[model samples]
Target: MREEELSPGEPAPRAREPVFLLPGSVSALAIILVLIQFASTMVLNPDGQNMLLYWFAFQPLRIVASLTDPSLALPLLWTPFTHAFLHGGWEHVLINVAWLVIFATPVARRYGTVGMLSLFLVSAAAGAAFFAATTLLEGVYLVGASGGIAGLTGAAIRFIFQPVLVAHHPETGERLVLGRRLASLREVFANPSSRYFTIVWLVLNAAVPLMPAVIGAQLGVAWQAHLGGFIAGFLLVPLFERRLA
Candidate 1:
């Protein structure tokens, strides 16, 4: 069962909240990206210019530059929060949207909207840091919300492992405890239709790096970014999602 539509054993619904309190904060990120794409197209100069990185994008060098060069420092350095909203193309935006809708809703329901924002920002930074660290050895630019979505993937893994006691019925004092079952994650994985797709995801990730290495193609996947993002969420989600017995 999806998180929003809880099982028959779970708690009943509550009153409506404000609009900003969205179930998936990643949905907001997706909307922001659409705006960014439109703005980039309208404003981009074709004279071999890179305004996206210089002004709109998050520059890793800026952090180092801010530490050493006082002149390079801007008073308002809130670009990191904005960077994930900017993407290279429709493909980049669509992929993030797909990932967000698939996993982020459950994450936000468990942790709330602010917590979702934390996963996105921290995961993005973690991914960027990994990218930056690797570029020191071999230069490459990392773009897109794959890293943020990877964090959600990691969080989902942890969430699925919880011991959920689902009680049912009330008036006649009846309750059937599923009692620490695999109802949560199994609902998504224990399906014949999805088995092949899950295998392809893992296989593609494993094979992408080898493709570039084997074919002498300079381009390769950001395996490190995926790794970093996953680690961040796997480590951080428990801190945000705390429930008393």
Candidate 2:
């Protein structure tokens, strides 16, 4: 007769445990990329690695040459997307995987599997294009998933900071929310965490190019790609978002 009382045949509800799980689509893609990088480094010799980079890495010089000569056009066509899967080293791939997991989880949860894949492909291509446009050198190569990860981060900012609707569970006393809504740009900036995140992201991107000189090491950070990907993700999230019912 009591509201919280269980019926004779009913079982009591279990408390929810916080468990961190790798998102399905993001994990699969990240693993594949890591495997490819590992294979390129361990299975292949130095010459083979060079050949792999030549074929898959995005090179602005190749595109420029393709303009003058039609033969180079075909390879350049797919390099934008392919280059994202290739990495310069273990550190590069690992760093990307970390970011991919953090940012892509939110995106995969909000957007369907197809939407996540679409974001990655589009962001990667946009990042490559921007890098090619800004990079002045001829022989430089761009590789890694930083651009795609940056895009995921940008897409996440669109909705992650919004106030969630929550209520105490009838019996469990646990907080629960039905769904989330996108926060307005004003609201996002008004929140200290979101505001700081946006500001820090912008400053980091701006500072990336200078990092090589600052640290006195050749850290080939494609900051242009990061900016392009972030812009693309932030602007394009609306296109991918499900219409509220």
Candidate 3:
């Protein structure tokens, strides 16, 4: 067939959208987490690592003590969010980072960098609050990004399973074919996949305290933090979507 010529006013076809998934902000956050883990494991001596935890990790006892002693209050303000950046070991951080990619990507794509960061920080802080409420008077330090990751996971569930949408840019006519509609609460619970997933997540986290006995090892999984973060993400994602709307 002979080549066809475009009309005088017709625009050329838009370029293919890139397939890259990791947004710059998400990659930056992931890199920061890995670097912190590397520093904890390789660069920091035992004493230095301990000091890092003391200053950054979330501890229920410290929060309680801060109520009476203002001198011990400085760390309390930051530890809630900072502890999500700290980890107990390589395995802990690695697992959290993996989940962060899986869960945070969808959220970052929908909400943009600012919304993703807001959800993460708020969830981390909420996790610390839950941990403190459960472990008050029990000297336990909470670390790792699982709580924040769980929040991302919960936020993702709001739209992850919806049908993908295909549209074109108004100006460029680009073949933009991604993203799903945010599901309503009724829709989420009505759908078997999401409902079952939520139930399973809740059950697993509820059983976190008993994990040591079941596995015969001390895993120190903070279930309360996970639940708190999940709840926050699940409830707050609509607000993010609304803001965008």
After superposition of all CA atoms, the RMSD between model 3 and the true structure is 5.6
- Lowest lDDT sum, 10 consecutive residues, model 2, at 176-185
The alpha-carbon lDDT assigned to residue 95 of candidate 1 equals 76
Candidate 3 wrongly placed segments (more than 4 Å): 1-20, 165-178, 212-217, 242-245
Candidate 2 wrong stretches, greater than 4 Å: 1-20, 166-176
Candidate 1 regions with alpha-carbon error over 4 angstroms: 1-24, 47-49, 61-70, 73-80, 137-140, 161-164, 168-208
Cα-based lDDT for every prediction? 0.65, 0.85, 0.88
lDDT of 1 by residue, 24-123 (tens): 4656766877777777767667542265655545556655566778765462164444556667778777877878877787777777788887897788
lDDT of 2 by residue, 175-216 (tens): 877566766678778988888998899798979878877798
Best by lDDT: 3
Which residue pairs collide in model 2, if any? none
Query: Candidate 3 lDDT (Cα, whole model)?
Result: 0.88
- Which scores greater on lDDT, model 1 or model 2? 2
C-alpha TM-scores of all predictions: 0.68, 0.85, 0.84
lDDT (Cα, tens digit) per residue for candidate 3, span 51-144:
9999999988986797899778798989999999999888888889889988898899889999999999889888889888989899889998
Q: For residue 7, what is the lDDT in candidate 2?
A: 88
